[model samples]
Target: MNEAIKSVKLADMPDYELVKSGTGGCAGCPSPMGLRIVGKALGPNSIMVMTPSCAVASIGVMPKSCYDVPVLNVCFASAGASAAGVSMSLDAQLKSGELTGEKPTVFTWVGDGGTYDIGFQGISAAAERNDDFIHFCYNNEAYSNTGVQRSGATPKYATTTTTPAGKSAQKKNVPLLMLEQRVAYVATASLAYPQDFYRKVMKAKSIKGFKYIELHAPCGPGWKFASSDTVTLGRLAVKSGAWLLWEGEHGKLTLNTPTKPLAEGKMPLTELEDYLKAQGRFSHVMKSPQKDAVIDEMKAEIRREMDFMLGREKL
Candidate 1:
């Protein structure tokens, strides 16, 4: 584990007892760790709205819950709406003097599958209304809980059960989608940068309307990477410019970290190729020339996408 990640012992974490032994999160799941850090940053008086993705499963079902704070398990497509509803209900209660506690922070925790696909409509509605809540998408790049299937968020050339070895399309730009919604806050964080991730979560909590955070979470089983390599892969993703941290607030854009312009130099294709090839998912692509061509085309698409995002006039 990285020193930063390792430094956060469970004892040092708030609500740590909630995640004690017998919790439903995967034995070594990074999702809970990310959530724990986020929950801590958000503080104890928050309500988490989880959908029918790994988050719901990991946190366990009600009556046998794992988290110390209040949690609402809604359907996969209703995370954002549920959060909005909860926020409204809380406001109503406060107005009626029916609730006597501090204002509660509402957070919607969804997977890439939920946010990038099925839950988009609800998310859009919430953002359109400028709902008061923090929406988090722990993007592992695919439908990891449903057996590593391809999702709208899955990158091109990445192998998933649905995409196979020769994926035909590029990954969906989800953060850009949120930016287009003109949400009050939109930021990207990675597990590799725990402090940054924690700070962003805290910042989002302090903000008032439709805050969206897309967290780059790596899945050991889905990515075919070693359990110990999660942070490494996350770092490599940022280093390659495949996943740059940035924020869009009220129509202005600011990159969280300085990114080398693609015009200056291209990402090392060989390094990316080796990283992909080492994974069992991309094994077939490594053996076939046609598949290699597809991978190259995908890389070009990524370059094009990045150029557009970074406001480059020409590729």
Candidate 2:
């Protein structure tokens, strides 16, 4: 893992004052908090391209918007394209001297449904072109906005409305896909590490060309967990080595946060059972007759993932 310089104190960062509190997000919905953190990191000159996602349903609704920064709501598949257009238009204005002062940073905020499935084409095209913008995917592991349906981001053994028997497929490795695009920056962040998340957002803002960050956003209602357990689940996920935190800059990968220690074997892996039992979505996984097999499968996957991150083998 490449070393990362220590980040600045949170108080020293800019206050964009964009995302407001008391939004329509459900209790423990991490979307609003994630948006707020990104907004503050980007400061005042920022334009967000939104899509048909839980975040949009919560904060980008018509007649009343909770964001202080400009948000353009597009179709589910158009977030990347829309943001690219905005970035080009802003660049044109800046070049023509029509837009003075600092130029607005273009960003697209979407959920896993929009990112891993519906909007993948547009996003892939934008990444290939090295578009000047940031793409943030707040993944809660399902189509959380539309009744907790299964999505490409859904983890194996997690039951959703469409996958009540537990999903047979593995979750999409989105960050690795972005890295394959050879973009300027790619990272994974968890709300449990607020400062780490904030630091990545700030780092992305400073870079040029395409940037992608996937945030591990825990959904309270969708996952059937206590609202207060949102942060706890996030922490456990990292400690358990189920979710790895890392950053890729200019094609170089560096493990970050709790993942670094786990991958390096400096820290013992937290019990996967502890993390799985805490979420109601995985209740079936624990009670199923094949529970032992399912648990072993999950454990194998984690080991393979950790080995890949530590450069022992490809995942």
Candidate 3:
């Protein structure tokens, strides 16, 4: 975990050491690394409402848990609702003088499949009510636990079990959807940039009401990339503009960083191709001309989205 943190440009602090060997995380899973970082940022005085995703499986059963903080593993569709309940209960306790000291920060941690699909309605209800909790979606881009199936958050032209390379539908814009709710804080982070991610997580901890962070967590087994390439893929995803890192408070929008300029000899599309080509999941796309066109179109869409978000005239 220390090595992974260092690789991702994050500090190797003692606080972020909850996930040790023997945990249920895969041999090299980015989700656990993300959990460790997020937990460290949120500190020990937080209550996590994890859903039926890799997070629950990774943390393992009861007595031998990977997380240092209190974890409430709930049903897949109840993450947001459960976290809201925790927040409400905490508030009630504080009001009744039944609890003293600082109130614990509540968090709902779910995967892309859980958040963008199965748990959408619960999340929407919570967000609409301006629930006081941090809702984090650690998107690996698919239903990884269920064998690399396509989820609403899956990228366009990506090859999942359900959506082959030839699939025509585009990925859902989840952050934008949450932004439309006019929540307090909405941002995007990736495992590759941990300092940035940690900062956002810490910022969310300090804020009140529906704080949502969409964290990009790479999967070695599902994405068919080597574990070592997780950070590389993360960087490439942002550089390609496929994953925009921005924050929206109320109705305002701010691009955290300018997209890597294509005119400045930075060919994110080529880099993205190189990154994807290394993965077996996208191997078939490389061999087919039609799939290559789809990939190009996806890249174009990414560029367009970045341009729109950054308020730029063109890519």
Candidate 4:
């Protein structure tokens, strides 16, 4: 039943609530926003595969789920492989007329620690083979569920359990990597803009082959920010040009609104300082001798990313 979808406006958001309330999560959690909208967009005919991540903790143990859809918990590095197997099995049964129901959509819900590092091997293999599944990487920028340790997606100068002083390396560009792999769809979404993410998820549900969507999850406890300030922090991250909003299908890229002008250089990136300062993770950098240097480096990286994504610069 998947096909070209009409644009889903904020007001047009469906009432189907696949993810229920009273689920476990830190106060002011951002992943729930994604879970809710993604559920609505995918509707009820979907099976979700999960790895070790915040959702595992929030949604609780098996048979104790608040989710309305079928969920399979897989090993940390096997979400891609596991979901692919399930999809293929469903297809086989459907073709034989042995399974009855709407064609089930298979997808994975994972975190940055899984996607950018350990699970990349399996995820990449699945992508290379064009697996019929969707992988959602909810990046809080660290292994927030496990002592706030650093991960490949951790931004520079952020203090994590493993990188107390600061991190030296830049974040791995997973979406760009997916684009290079020539997947069917690659997109970046943020919690502050549910409408953008909702539409993208709905569109990806209709597309064949691998689909990857990385959500910019705002971490409160992990980032040392209040839960209530999560949404504002996400908006600040975008205004500062730290995070981007975009989608690409079959190599045709379209920069979404809000971020379009920023990438086009029509709007100045003026909120980087506020964005970084709002989270305590970067407090050490802000008070250090290299404060200006650190921020300058971050700005430079953001510009470089935007320019590269816009095809104005070579990688």
Alpha carbon lDDT at 99, candidate 3? 90
Give TM-scores for every candidate, taking all chains together and pairing residue i with residue i: 0.86, 0.95, 0.89, 0.95
Worst 10 residues of 3 by lDDT: 1-10
lDDT of 3 by residue, 23-98 (tens): 7877668888787888778777888888878878877666888777788988878888899999999999999999
Query: What are the runs in model 2 whose C-alpha is more than 4 Å off?
Result: 1-5, 10-16, 312-315
Model 1 RMSD to the real structure?
A: 4.7
The positional error of residue 18 in candidate 1, measured at the CA in angstroms, is: 6.3
- Predicted candidate 2 versus true structure: per-residue lDDT over 1-315, tens digit per residue: 223645767787566677776578888889987887887788878999999887888774576788888889999888889999999998899899998888788999999999999999999899999999999999999899899999999998888999988889999898988876679999999989878888888888888889999999989888889998998999999999889999887667788867988888898989999999999999998888888998998999998998887782232
- Residue 205 lDDT, candidate 3, scale 0-100: 78
Question: Each candidate: what lDDT?
Answer: 0.75, 0.87, 0.78, 0.87
lDDT of 4 by residue, 116-167 (tens): 9989999999999999999999989999898899999999889999998889
Residue pairs with backbone atoms closer than 3 Å in model 1 (clashes) = none
Q: How many angstroms is residue 229 displaced in model 3 relative to the true structure, after the best TM-score fit?
A: 1.4
Candidate 3, RMSD to the unseen true structure: 4.5
lDDT of 4 at 211: 98
